[model samples]
Target: MTESKADQPDEKARPRRRQARGERRIQQLLDAAASVFCRAGYTSASTNAIAREAGVSPGTLYQFFPNKEAIAVELGERLNRRMLETHGVVFTLENAALPLRELIDAVLDPMIEFNCANPAFLTLLQSSDAPGHFLEEHAALHDSIQDRIGELIGVRNPDLSPERRTHTANMAFALFKAGLGLILGHEGAEREAYVAELKTALYGYLAPVLGTEGVPAQP
Candidate 1:
């Protein structure tokens, strides 16, 4: 006798449920890896520990990531993409002439928001992945970010020499990364004050590019 829909095996639904289970397993692994890396750093974190943390076997973890470094690299790539997109939104030419305080605040606010929202990203930033490897791993996304920053600079300063523009971009990127590190590494009022100071320092440099007033407290 033919079975009713309720009694019949839902072949399509079974595959969908399996796919979801697979995704959940991978996410659990990533989440556990993030926690492990944050506490142990990538170099010392172990696949076995991560698997244990994820409530999975080392073999199961391997199905998702070949090694610890692979997980760290993937996390870094994801974090970098998130920062680029969010920070891009935060700092814009629309505030092209804002004073140093506002400009710095604008630049840092998004970073603070993103880091606070995703502590794993901050942890990923501490990984010892080789230089340019994350960018290489997420090439198209990173390139799009580079292009956006390039455009922002051009809009902010039509006369900045190409060499200077490149230098400025590199400096800004470095400062943003360092700022997040500083903020995440510290605690209490001290971290908040440091972030403010770092923002001012960055804005002091950016003032020239924006053609806005220089930093109020600087000579």
Candidate 2:
């Protein structure tokens, strides 16, 4: 007997619909969490506040997350994944031949944009009241970024010994982190000036080791 299209089991479609709804709900919760954390700080943030921000009942939020920490963990994981993706693009062979200034810009621009758009990331990470495990997870992501930056350095400056490359990479990451702080801490002309200065400083530090000479003067 031939079954009508509408009479088919439709098992796959049912799960797909349910999964899509579930994902949408989770996104709502995370978005609300980000806003709440940003405004209230991690310690002051509460599940009830997040639920209100999400426009869902407290029970609904609990269905997706056990507590505020779980919400933070998920958000941190998502941000780390994005950072990895940005680094992957910047550290590729295609970008290895870029001039020192352009290379640093390529790496820093996307990262800075991400940080600016997701201010809660910095807020949650820097808060002393955040869970120890959450901080540890963030630290691990930072280390992964540093390791990849070391690899990129080796690719661009093949003569550098592994130890020297690691040291340089660590220093460069520290500088980049500080640059992020400065950018976030200012606005308008000051932020633009700080960004320019950061690029020049990075170029000067990198040029000697990367064997790139006579790089253009800073703007």
Candidate 3:
């Protein structure tokens, strides 16, 4: 029997809804895996526990991801993407033009917020020794900071050389990562103190490249 044309739209909508459901399932698995990995570490985290946390069967978990490492890799990718999106929203041209200290604070604020809100996320990052092919697979994403900085600098000062742009991006991310380590690995006043030091180090490094005028005047 021939299907009615009217049903075609409904059929298409069904597929979209199913895809959305699948994506949600994958996200749930990742969220649960993040917690399990954080508590147990990568070497000891079990698929059974992750599956239980996700409220899915082991078979269902395997259907979405082959194993724990795949889950870890996907979670890391999502975390990186999420961080970039959060930072991107906060780091506007106006904020970017702020003194290097303020700019660093802007970037670090969301990151620290994310870590505090999702301690499991940081634990997962700290658990692994850095995925070996992580850089290769996520090179574009990892370099997103540099790319955005390069774009902003180009708009502000067209003559900024590629080397200079690259340097600024590299310096900023290095300090950001170091700050993240201190914040995630420390607690209370010590964390606050480290963040202050990190801001100073980051701004001092970028001041030469961005110039005092480009730097945000206030923190």
Q: Which candidate has the top score in lDDT?
A: 2
Winner of 1 and 3 under TM-score:
1
Candidate 2 lDDT for residue 167? 97
TM-score of 2: 0.86
User: Candidate 3, clashing residue pairs?
Assistant: 98-215, 98-216, 99-215, 99-216, 99-217
- By summed lDDT, the worst window of 10 consecutive residues in model 1 runs over 210-219
lDDT of all predictions = 0.72, 0.85, 0.74
* Candidate 2 per-residue lDDT over residues 1-219, each given as its tens digit: 898999887899999999999999999999999999989999999999999999999999999999998999898888777777777777765566677777777888888888888888898889987777778878888888888888778877778999999999999888888888999888899988888888888888888887563233322
Candidate 3 lDDT by residue in tens digits, 69-176: 788788877776776678688657777676556666776777678776666655654554546554444566556666876666554455788887777677677777
Residue 104 local lDDT, model 1: 61
Per-model TM-score, in order, reads: 0.75, 0.86, 0.69
Decreasing lDDT order of the candidates: 2, 3, 1
